[model samples]
Target chain A: MVDIISQGINLPLPLLMLLLGGLTSLMVGLLSERIGVAKLREVWMIIVSAATLTSIYYLNQSVQKAGVLVISIWGQLPPLGGCFEIDTLSIFMSGSIAVLGFLVALYSISYMEKESRLTEFYTLMTFMMAGMTGVVMAGDMFTLFVFWELMGLSSYVLVAFLKSKWGPIEAGFKYLVMSATAGAFLILSMAIIYGMTGTLNFAAIADNLRGAAVSPWIIALFSTLVVGFGVKSAIVPLHTWLPDAHPEAPSPISALLSGIVIETGLYALARVLFLTFDPGMFKLPIAFLAVLTMTLANVMALLQTDIKRLLAYSSIAQVGYMLIGLAAGTTYGFMALFLHIFNHSMMKGMAFLASGSIVHETGTRDISSLRGIGKMMPVTSLSLFIALLGLGGVPGTNGFISKYHLFSAAFGSGLGWLGIMGVLNSALSMAYYIRIMQVLLGSPKEGFKANEAPILMLTVTMAMAAIIVILGIWPAPLINFATSASQSLVEGLSTYIGAVLG
Target chain B: MVPLEPFLVSVGLMFVIGLYSLMVKRDMVRILIGVEILFNSANLCFIALSTQVPGFVDPYAHSIVMMAIVLDGTVIAVGLAMVMNVYKHYKTIDIRKLRRLKW
Candidate 1:
């Protein structure tokens, strides 16, 4: 029985932690009402998130092992069954997701204190975290899509958590429509790929693509995949739902949405383009999309007045920068891309949390209504200031480091025009961030109270703010990790082929 | 066996119609129906694709699509519920009335 169970399933430590977290959260949620364990729910969520992060941290230590740690539920091998695979890329992403998820859960404790559906919020958040972790660790396309829906569904519900508010309901409805359409595109693409390759495994598909003739059908498959993933990443022309969805969500959820959810989409796009398909075939289109996304998003962001909406557009712009790196299709490009993921997460996470604090104190998200709030909420204001500077790619922040690498990669890939546009957009983004800062710190408006944000919110904002600065100054460790992960992604194609075919 | 071409074409037509309605319709419930049409079209496409495989119907893909369909139904159901709430709060189903998002 042991041998049978161990046949094709190799469970890694990090995935085990995630699975444990998911199960524990579900169990607590189910028993919370009966056991009258209201306080225990929060404790359980924090413990699960922390344990998941700790396990992912340990997994990062051995990520250079260069192959997948697979685990089977039904004890069956690939091409015939499903399993989980923890690689360097997966572990790195899983670690970051765990970290952000833990922080967001921490932030949510105080954020949702007055809300009645606290248990539902924490329960849904746990499932969402589990889904994201699953997406990162999935070895097969089927597993990725399954977890993708899991995350998407939970997020849709969470977006409308305040059901009484028409804004959230409408926003959630629009989000569902867009997301469902994207899912259709994804499934159709997967069907086409399966039709051609006869397998749903990522490694298998890569192997098939390497030797197969490039037909129009394959091109169509690629196009569908791009559109599917592009919508999730909020790429141009498919980004209408984002500006509505982000601000409509609760602050902590918005932080998660902007910080990591969209990045996961970009990660999937990069994985498919670089890992499963030939990069040479998609280079020009990817570059075009990158340039267009960066330019359009910056322009839209400049026209926004609501603080969260502005940040939402800016998040789309950040995804554009990462796309530039991925489009370059070099090991260095992937490194820049991965590094920007971390940088963007920290910066945006801080920005959203700070915005949440302001909204909590001021009771509004209008940029114009927030005059002189910096003096009112010093800690929140300072955190927002740092995050704004970081977001604008100012010196002494993580954003500058990542954006610089991205520009360098763009130039190195001979897309110097793209690099120039990226710089222009970075500079353009500064106007909005600075404008918000000016309004917050400039002069007191009548009827505005001078009050500090809740301690929980302030702590979360300050923590992310410090990390942004620290990562900016001493980026060697992060640079090395991203570099190695990117190298593993670029170099693992051969190993991947061997693994899938064996 | 029945011909698959007409079924495939009908599915494609349904998808196009759904997109058309979703883009043009202002009523919330109408848009929901449009979403349902789009989802059903995708399911039809999947079922057709499953039939193309040689021997077995590719149980894995079929099952995944089945799950996706269920998810789609649930999502639309949630959307309709939200629309009901929107009507209660705003007293209208016209999306133009929900102009809170406009700059």
Candidate 2:
């Protein structure tokens, strides 16, 4: 079955499903319109995402057997043409994307029911997921760039989806200009890489350029690459657009954007950075960036009165935490990084979804106005409480477990100072989390009213909360999966290059 | 092989000009054009580098540039759409005026 598709570009099963699903969404929208069926686009979205998850399972099994599955394109293999090189790491990242996408699709059905242009919404959402899937699995730089832009374009439109609003329009334009500039940096980085190694395939580039002596050009390449991927990931100094874009976007998109999209950018940065230079070479700079991102975002989050905007700032803080693992640059550090990515997806995704439900019912994002609404929306508030606790790294939550590993990984790698700073920031972040909790559980203002979110939204948030707790207490399976995933990147370099060169 | 210095120098100059326009220009459309200029400089770098390959120009870089051009165009298109929306709301394309959302 895979052989037949080798005639063109060989995409992993899940990516192919998403891309095909995105393309057909418009036709399905028309068909549903003609048939006058309600929720047809919503149902299609759920099915496509569910199918994507299942395909990732199958692909994982094959990757376990094959070590690295390189599906060539147009009869041209890697080091020459674009292809997909699926290993455990790709499988893990794509799996996280699919899981969050499926959850968000379900949540969107209820959250966006009243919004017009359902067709375009679902189509763009699907393409966004497809683009992310393609990015993690891309064997070559050009393919990654293509998918990266697809993700960026879809997101820019989605951020401005509520076109009637001045807020979304202004924020979307700012995001577009900033991100488009980053795209140019990406192209420049590619040219630099191509100039250095005369190839863009990941395996080939790694083989040719890894551990080369540092030159002035290499430093230039490093800065360009950082600027390129940094904007999307919301690294400090490039993070101005994020606090706007995340809050302006629809809640489900906020969930996806904050949940996995930024992580996808970090994933690319980790992959390329690891492939190009030794961990020691990048350890100090990334560690410095980690400190800056965490400290600044947490401080800013403390001041946001808007609920979603606070969450957006908190997302940047979480990115800072994840960078500790990257700075550690060990296999263990990578494992912790991947684990945090998944856990944070569940935690942050649920937080946004729950907050979205609150906003949907209450029609306000101002925290002061939301006082004592927890009693009215008991289930959503409870789930959100769990999510907030997880984000704050409270015990018996997956966030705690991952944060423990992340900090310990920093310490273990002889970066005790980074670990200390991380611990302080974790404590600092809890201030805002507690503020939100107090608002939710505090006494209600006069005439304040909000019933619980609809059954679908409640169920999704509750299920995510349950996973957060379940994995927190018993995280062995996920830890093992993360270990293998990181190993595929950190320790599997020889096999990675061999798949192409041997 | 073609000389690499001249091409590199021009790429550097174009990059600085692009950044200058992006920073100094307040018009939304001009900012989009600035992004286009930045993209073109990178594409030209690829084309120039492709020429320096020993005996034949690498078609691979050319192919990547072709796709990159389309990608940038689509990005600019989206930016322009958003600019239209911005104009509708604020009745001005000056970026400084669109600063309602802030800390």
Candidate 3:
């Protein structure tokens, strides 16, 4: 083990963090029930989260030493074997996921203690985190698909954690149906690509794509891939399952679902689109899809009464913004997309955590029932307000910076219509966000009383809120990171192709 | 004209049957069976593809298909567990009544 660690190809520290967390959580879960010790579960969760956060910090530092780290597991070569490749792009995502994951774990301590299946909940959460991290760091198609399924399966189980609740069970069922169909489409696409190119590694596919003639079959493969990932990313038409699934999930899991997991799907989409096919194949359809996704999601979000459902719709809308960035097929576009990925994770994670606190205290998730909650749960309400504003792309918030860059990238790419649609959606999202605030701050309704969330939850919310503000104001390092990560994606293609085919 | 071999015709027929059952089946248990049939059809297709590739059965695709079968088995097992839970909760196997998410 020591030799492996010392001689290891430069692995991103975040991946190790997630692996350790998942393993520890699984061990603790198995033992905690047998030993009849409850506190040990909490202790294990905290230790796992801390270790993940520390590893993320170390990963950020290592980014300076290595432009990007590409590591293979079990010394496996690509195309025929699975591998993990860490670049600046993946490291940035892993870091953001770790930060939010740590806070959510802390929040879950107070939020989930009263529940009977606490150990199971923590174990699934850790596994889900590890899966997401794996998806981002995956070096090849097979690895990405395997980790994608891991993330999807864990989330399906988590969505129905409240087994007795009809809402959660039905939501989980719908999610499973949609998710399984998507997984099948993904498998079919992979098989076709392998049949055509005789290799499963992404880099090999790209090389074959350049010299190989485009056939109708290739188009079918790409379309199938779009549908598969589109469902996970909650693109317009494919987004029906999300509004139900996100809200039905526990709030911490909702944070993960909305914040990191969906974005990981989009990240994979972008990586595949940019790496596997020429820019010409993607230009028209992706831009058109971006426009449709943005417009449709914002329109649907306007009608939602449930706060979590509204946010879920907004999550789809945000994915559209990232799609617009990626469709540009430029370094600036990749930068904008990744920047939004980080910012959205922080802002949405805070929002979901705050929503959890609200539900914890009020025992309801309806926007109307949450009326005057600002006066009762002042801290939670304030953090939520900040999150909403950030989500709406208000100035001095991280959302604003990322959205601004995305809009600029769209315009630079000459897709002014997409830029306009994105701006319009941002304005439209504000309407629902502000309405929720109004309800939260308004007069108390009959049978309503003041209550606050637990201190641990409050601390987690405040920490995320602060990071959102800080990153918004001082975004130079993040901007640099995003730019470099985008460069790595665009510049490393030839090397990747050569490495695989040679 | 392309020759329609009996084995190829049977594979196609099995695929259509499996797809039809998957779409028409109301019972969760039946749906799992349909999925199993689809898996077998796909396995048949894999064998066909391997034969077309000349010498040895393309070990790469063969291994991938094997892995996929294992994965499908696990997924079906989980689906069965979920079906058990549904039976305990709603006391029925029909999917039409599971309408908690409808707008």
Candidate 4:
């Protein structure tokens, strides 16, 4: 038999890592019945994370060294079986997803100690991880939709995993309905695109649609895609499910959802819009969403009493900031957007996990009741503090680097107003971060005693915080990778088209 | 000839009705049914659109619609499972009553 990958590339291993996660999930229920599922989950998650990281790293190296690798099953062409386009962008995203997944999985071992359904939790989470990897790497629209559903399905289950609680079940239902509606629009778009271009492959669709005349229906197609994807990404008007869904899930899962789920939606949107339509026509609408999503989410964040809810709103706002870069439609703007995606993932993951440790120890998520909890749980509080600074775009945190570039890139790309709005929003966001700190460290509340979280959780949070600071100061490497990715996207459909069709 | 207008018109009307019920329904079960209706409408679009192409049926659209149905079924199954859990906790699946996770 001939080798399957067209470009002599190795089998797309990141996808393998993801699929393995889903495959292994079937065994988790049975296995957990016999052994300590939590501990077993930790081991399994570590292995999955290692594979993910190794796969992503090798994928990145290959893209950087060789070229964009298109891997299809059984050597089938694009129109036949689904294809995976391993490029700088996909690998960059998978790298963050894998790394955060490892840390969150590690932290969840300790955090979810008292929670029931260990195997189910880990299984859904792994399935979710696999789904994300698939979405990022998917070269065909149908493949992306498949993985998108995989991601959405697992998240719905994970959100409601704590089924006994009324809050989780309620939130999970709302999330399911909203996301399912979004899924409907997604398929609706796919059906129309199939009807229009008579192809489903991303690159092939791009080639066909670009040559076709721009009709009114094309706008409808784009609008449906935006609405479908925007709901998943939680862009402004469609973002109601996010705050509820993010806060109701297990903290580690919340970290994953907040950190990467919405971001992946945006990623898919960018990829599809770039592949199929004339992107210049769409930049203004994207910029409009960017402004609206950021400003509203930040204002909401300032009003939250629950720490996790606060972070959740803040996550939506950060998506707004990332969109500013995306809307700029410049090479640097795109690079900055990807960079912030990675940076925000680390910062938000750390924040959610650190807060999880606090909630784990103190049995509360209210910032008011948890006065001086920072003193009680020193490491976690500190991590939360650093994560907050990163979130607020403090000078020495990783967030600063991305946000700074984002604003500059916006202005450079002639969206000076967007840059100004971003700065104002970042400034507006700082108020809540300060309030969190005051609650965490300002004064001691009587009769509230909580110790530090477990060693495992502590190690993970601190490691992420340290990374935030390090990346903040020395972001050269990430910036380099992001620029290359952006360069490829900005260069347009030629390279991507050639790779897929051959 | 499978006259395309009627199929498109019916699918469009059903989609609107499903979305309307989905938005307006207060009961969770009703909401789930609304979702199912929307999904079936989408499936109808898929199948109906396939008929427009000349000659034989489009296998890709058929396969895609089938996959979509399976995926849609999975979503509703989970939705129903969640509905069961909701009823277990609150003794009702009324969407208006479940006000726990707001804001």
Candidate 5:
């Protein structure tokens, strides 16, 4: 069984594909440059990301059959050395990453064709996806941190890729400073965990530390963990960089960052908090942060003039909503959480891509200046309208389906007030979504001219829009997958530990 | 056994110093240095905690610290590159001067 899984692949299949693809693409990039071949790197990226998706499908089959597949690095067993433990949850999360990456790679071909530095852009983007994949599949704290840094490093460069402008440079620096600080706190948290448990493995740490009585060390660990993960996730107080950074990055990257990258941070937070403490222990504090995150980000999002920045703030507010599921701390709640993660990735990712098409055509991100864009670019504007409605949780959209499940899960867990706050915030967020919609649908301003976006970008946005609508209507399959994913994390604890310890 | 109090106190002090510099420093390069200090403080905490075990030091913490230091160096390298770009654009490394992107 082991040999079958390991045949010609030492690491997890998705991670190996991504890492190898990222490395070889660097060479491909240089060769393309020397050979005067254009669009070669873009083609390589598209194949790599698509292959990553296929590998995840294969890995998912193995995970389902084995229940948990533990792959130790350097031939060292777990609880002592670094490893990757893939359960249903890892497959689900990495599947989301690869899906978004594949779509973004396709969209970037048309979107970034005019930009220079194609090599660095495609390579760093691939590494960034590879990093997120490793992070989700990581079995130990050190492995997670290493991949976390890899993700962080690649994103910092990608955020700053267009250095000809001051906006990206400044945003990238601020992002780097804050994220590097978070990385430091993550190390400190690891040290404290080691001090408490004498091992860095997730299963070992969970074995030793979960349900331990409240102590100063536990309190310190909790705060450090929050600080470490919160900045990247853009939890309210640590979120200043996001509004700037997300908008300043190139549009496709903006889509990826606001779409899945922040959710990856929230995913790490959920995984660690669940492993180290009982759900009852951290529920209230996380709940409180959820309220703060939602209220503040919604209010800020309402005030934004720039379309992408507004979407960035809305992303934070969505993170706030995801935290409600975490705070509820039920299997049902976790299912809701992961459900919302996938749904939001599609909705927000499409929203950004659609807006990116708008920006590419009109050369502006200001919402007012985009008046009558719907008239000029009917297909792009139509997709954007669908994306906006999905994000606002309108009925018959996937966002509403996941959000309905999320709020009910909160109420089911006796967090009725949180559910109420979530509903109110959902209502409040619609104001901005409608604002964008109105801008798109309004009569055209004089002298405004834009043709429909290129066929590739339009197809990607329309595909995501179709997904949002189709899943909204027939959500049973996705809901079932999310339920299994959450069950692995919340109820399959024993199986996960046994896979690691034995 | 070696006492852990002094090492813990030093780590705490370094942390505070690093955060203070991060908050107060105007120079972008100094801010990056502050981040490096914070990283080193965490590395020191790991090393110190690894020593608390009697009769033998855990090699795991040493290995992690080695990897972490390299990671920190790369992060700072990226930060310095960003700082250079900031200088080219704003003609100053003062972070406050790069405030064209306010809310």
Candidate 6:
């Protein structure tokens, strides 16, 4: 048994994490087809949950033990051969993906019970998990592209999963067209990189571009990648698809889209910009984008009537706050970005889950119709209150702590205006957050009786809400993790070049 | 020997045109075709870039182009399925007509 275990398991930690989870989900997904489709919900639930959880464990352990793990296939040469370099930045990202994926999958068990075709839903979600893992861990641009498409394809299917509704189908179509076009821009940019540097591996291109003089093509490359990734992350001017798709999809998947998917896309943008290009030239554009994204999203969110759509806009604004940290381009900037990513995932995930409970009970997500919902279901409303407090950056919530770090990074890096604008955006966000709380706590409308959400959903929602406060009060551990992850990214590029070309 | 520069320019134009259509075309089918055009342009760019290495074609570029085509095909197929659904539900594919959701 020992010999078998040692010999058969030489795969690197992060890729192995994605593969085991992905392959297991694919296998279970296929099996569920021949078996009674809806008969084995528990089986699908156990398999996916275990897969995501186990992968999160191994990836976390490996990053803790070894700072960065690079795995290449078939002894092929790099800057060309497909490769995976799992560092702290990628670990932090993949960990966030898997952690939220596990929680959402847990919530899905109770939430998706009334819906049919449960097997396929879990399968596609797992494939999406695998796709995201592949993207962040990719060592070369092409690998990232390949996995990006995988994630895109899976998400389109998910967005349209409620195919019986015209709204879902329409939202899915718009999302597909926009996302696919963005993908083309990414490929074009990659071709430009290859045309100049003749390598797809990130480290080699960084070294090549670093030694070269500034050129017009390089600038175009930056803009195209930004546009390509910005759409997925729901940056302003390209965020029109989010409100429609998020509101139309099932709630757990809404959590997945809002909580993890958009951020992963932003991670690619930050990774490419931070590691592969001149950070100085890109800083201003990113800062401009940050300011634009926050202000516009806040304004739109203030006028929203639907619940999920409101959360979707709020998600875009959070990305803006993270982008401010990115524009600062310091280790502290990166720290702020990562810390806020973790915190927002908790707060927003809980927010969507709680609202989903409301929608589930009431069958309507319109803000006007849901007045006084808190009077009927205290637990769910309490969860929503906690979520709102976190989003509003109340003193004792995780959102405030992360936003504090982000503002400090902005000011410390001489972008005091950006930090101040960020504070203003947070203040603007308060108007809508308070509106939601008011509606939840208002007088109970006659003829509306909503039972409490299922135990499984309530537990998941409460768990995320509690984690927000706990992390806010004692934020040292998550902040330390974010600090270490950012430190690795700032310091790891040269070490990355040495390892790749050694 | 063929001039790759003109070919690259043409393909670049093709991509820009497709992007324009994707942005402005209200008809769903036209947008899907625009996506196809962009994919073909990207494929052309990949093939053109491979000409730099003399005497042998770059296998990696070939494989990537092939994979992109397949993914592109999947996207188009999905888009078509969506169009069919739209036609069934609303009897037309004009983008403006499906305005129930506030954009």
What would the per-residue lDDT of candidate 5 be over residues A425-469, giving only the tens digit for each residue? Answer: 999999999999999889997887888999999999999999999
Location of the lowest summed lDDT over 10 successive residues in candidate 3 chain A: A1-10
TM-score for each candidate, following the candidate numbering: 0.94, 0.99, 0.92, 0.96, 0.99, 0.95
**lDDT tens readout by residue for model 6, A1-502:** 0011112224445446555655665566567667747545446656655665676677667666766666665455565577777777888888888788888988888888889777678777877877888888887898899889889998999999999889999899989999998988888888888878777888888888864666888888888899899889998989999989988999999999899889989889988888666667778889999999999999999999898899999999999999998999999999999999988988888899999999999999999899999988899999999998999899999999999989988999888999999999999999999999999999987888999999988999999988998998999988888998888788777766665665
lDDT of 6 by residue, B1-84 (tens): 356798789888999999888879999999999998987897888778877776777777787788888889998998898899
DockQ of 4: 0.75
Worst 10 residues of 5 chain A by lDDT: A1-10
Poorest 10 consecutive residues by lDDT, candidate 2 chain A: A1-10
Per-residue lDDT of A1-502 in model 3, one digit per residue for the tens?
0011113444446666666767777678778888888678878877887887787677656654655444556555555665665666777777777777888888888898788877778878887888888888787777788778888878889998998877887787768766766776676677667767776777677877754557887787779789889999988888889999999999999999999999999999998878777766787789888888888888888888888888998898899889988888888988999999989999998898899888888788888777888888999999999999999999999999999999999999888988898898889889988898898789887778967888899999999999889988999988998888788788766654554444
TM-score of chain A of each: 0.95, 0.98, 0.94, 0.96, 0.98, 0.95
Report the CAPRI category for model 4: medium
The better-scoring model by lDDT among 3 and 6 is: 6
Report clash pairs, candidate 4.
Answer: none
Worst 10 residues of 2 chain B by lDDT: B94-103
Write the candidate numbers in order of decreasing lDDT.
Answer: 2, 5, 4, 6, 1, 3
Two-chain DockQ for model 1 = 0.57
lDDT of residue A231 for candidate 5: 100
Q: Which of candidates 4 and 5 reaches a greater lDDT?
A: 5
Error of 4 at A3 (Å): 10
The alpha-carbon lDDT assigned to residue A398 of candidate 2 equals 100
Check candidate 6 and list the clashing pairs: none
**Cα misplacement distance, residue B41 of candidate 5 (Å):** 0.6
Give the clash total for candidate 6.
Answer: 0
TM-score of chain B of each: 0.85, 0.97, 0.80, 0.92, 0.98, 0.89
Task: Tell me which residue pairs clash in candidate 3.
Answer: none
Steric overlap count per candidate: 2, 0, 0, 0, 0, 0
